[model samples]
Target: MSHSKSFSLQKIINYIGGTLIFFGVTYFVYSNWLSLNDFFKIFSTLGVALAAYIVGALLYLNKEYDEVGSVFLMIAGLILPVGIFIAFKLTELITGINNLSVVSFSISLVAFLLIFFYFGRIILLLFTIIFASLLFFAVMELITTKLNYFFDDLIAYQLVVLGSSYILLGYYFDLIKKYNLTGSLYFFGVLFILSGSYFLSGILSFDSTLWKMIVGVIILLSFILSVPLQSKSFLYFGAIFLVLFLVDLSRRLTPFFGEAGWPLILISLGFLFILMGSLIFHMQKKIKK
Candidate 1:
């Protein structure tokens, strides 16, 4: 019991200490911002990030201190992007690039990915994903703005594509037994797909029948895939989106159906829900087995 307590306590101290160091440096820089030259400002952040990363890498070699090392690594990851941004701004590179955010995120993504490959660390991979996502958005924004090709639903289409890509990546991670990373990918993937489809459905305006049909198909696919994938994330997100779709469909049908058809629709939907519940329960049981 004492040993377990001490272990937890040590972890808390390590985390707190790492956090304090990061904040202390940030505060010091912020406080001295007026007095510092551009060179000092840019290098301060980069230098600190490098120092933290090196310390973390060295500490990672000792098994007992590996977790503490991860805290420092995370600190480095968090600060590195800020440092990159400062460097880009100070160097006046933004004027040369069509999209500074895209360039910076690209650089950050590659750096983090290289570090992740060298260290085999999940936290670094998380940073890589974050920067990659930023790069995607930055590029999307640039394309839409520069080309003037952005329709009302362009973002929706982009999200659907991005979500599908995330799901495929999650599947690849699953193949390699990277379950921790897989859950996040699955979660964000489903979230983006459903949210995008929801927007495309024109729930408020009933603007697109084709998109509504597509949304229904996606919901069905989620439920169907959930059983095979053993993903409760898929099941629950599907159920929620299904309810939203039904609600919107019902609202749209109100004028056509009149008052008499309302009760019938409600009864039919209630039965459908019961059936869905039964299926979900059985599917979950099967997955557990």
Candidate 2:
């Protein structure tokens, strides 16, 4: 217990220090941006990233200082993309917000993933996920702009696909006993799935029975999966989205059913909420057992 506590505390301290250093350097660069020459501008960011990465690699060789080494690595992770972006911009290789962002993020993603594989550093996996997400968005944006292929619910479909992938990846991570990574992926996965489904359900647009049915099924599955996954996040988000769906359904029905149906809607939703609460409570008990 003591060792675990110490490990946790050390990680917290290292992360805090890393964050401060990143921000401090960022501020100094921003403050001196105009005064610095082109060389300094490029060096300040890339130079720091390189130095931090080298130091992190050296420190990571010692088991006792691995967490501190991770802090430096994280600093590298945070700055490397900015460095790449700046370098590309300065070289006139990137003119605007186009494929350049994708290229930069792809490089960062590959770098972090390779480092993680070599060192087995979980922290690098965080960067891997972040850069991968950025790359996905950049690619999507490029497609939207270049192809002019933006369609209704196009982004929603993309989110659903991404969310499904994240959910599966979370399960894989859980199988490997990477609980922290699992939780992060699960949280974002559910959020993206629910958010995309909500929009696709036509809550903000026209009513569609098909989408409503699909969303309802998704919510039901979320609740069911919670027990098997041992993930409260799935349960909680399921309930939250359930409420939102019900409220939206009621609003959509208000005009059709008239004011007389308002009372019925409220009473029905009330009963439904009670029933769901009871079911969830039982599920939680079963999960504990």
Candidate 3:
């Protein structure tokens, strides 16, 4: 197929896959609304493995358009299912095998090894860092017996680290027209931001009042930096952060205003949305001109 035709087909496939996945998750959640914990326990690992396989298959099918990393992802897709199944069986047979941690560590390690083989030293190094971070968390959880706190904190730290890596990677990819890099950057950046928000919320457990203000300030600064970047990707990031900031601020202020605070929150959200939309439009027009 011609490049354009191939691109169009890939786009269609992606759209279909995304739609199906969304509906699948929604259906699953709705069906098990009363037993959400059980639902997650049964499906979360399997769901992730299945999704990875689908993604890898898609990449492999578009091998002509994909790079070495795509091939690696395909390999990962294949290995994930097998790895999970093996981990499950091993845990069942063994005296003290934690299936969840083992499966996660195995996948991360395999991914690190695969990327190392394909992309050389730099990518290998990056994957190694990711793998090690995950491994450290898994080991800590296994040893400490009450390492949930450490695990939670590590999760937040990983988000910041990984998210920063994505931004940097995306910057370089955008500069060089590397589509894979662009996609990776966007995916990881969003992951980082959302995870960071959750992490901040967790930190607020100690002192809600103080941490709320600090998080709000940090998020505001992030939005300011993102908005001025003149990049669609960055603008989107900024908009998300702005929305999160507004939500956080509203939640914090609601107690002070009692019932009246609800309307204030709605108005705040509406205004923020309008401001972000206008900013994005203005930026796009400037880019066109």
Best by lDDT: 2
Candidate 3 or 1, higher lDDT: 1
C-alpha lDDT values of all predictions: 0.82, 0.86, 0.57
Look at candidate 3 and tell me the lDDT of residue 114: 65
Q: Which stretches of candidate 3 lie over 4 Å from their true place?
A: 1-3, 6-76, 84-95, 98-154, 172-179, 202-207, 227-233, 254-273, 284-289
How high is each candidate's TM-score?
A: 0.85, 0.92, 0.54
Ranking by lDDT: 2, 1, 3
lDDT of 3 by residue, 1-289 (tens): 9998987787667546645654564566567756756436335444555555456445545555454334344334434444455445544643344446655666666765764565443434454545655666566557655444434365666567667666776677667764444555555675575557556565324345555565566555554554443345545665666576577667767889888889978887888789878876776654422
For model 1, residues 1-289, the per-residue Cα lDDT tens digits are: 6998988898888889888988988998899999999989987897788788888888888887888888988888778877877778878877534366777788778877887887787878888888887788878888878987868887888789888888998989988886378777888898899989889878665788888888899999988888777678788899888888887887677777777678877887899889888878887775533
Model 2: lDDT of residue 112: 84
- Model 2: ten consecutive residues of lowest lDDT: 203-212
**What does the lDDT come to for candidate 3?**
0.57
| TM-score for candidate 2 | 0.92
TM-score of 1: 0.85
RMSD of 2: 2.0
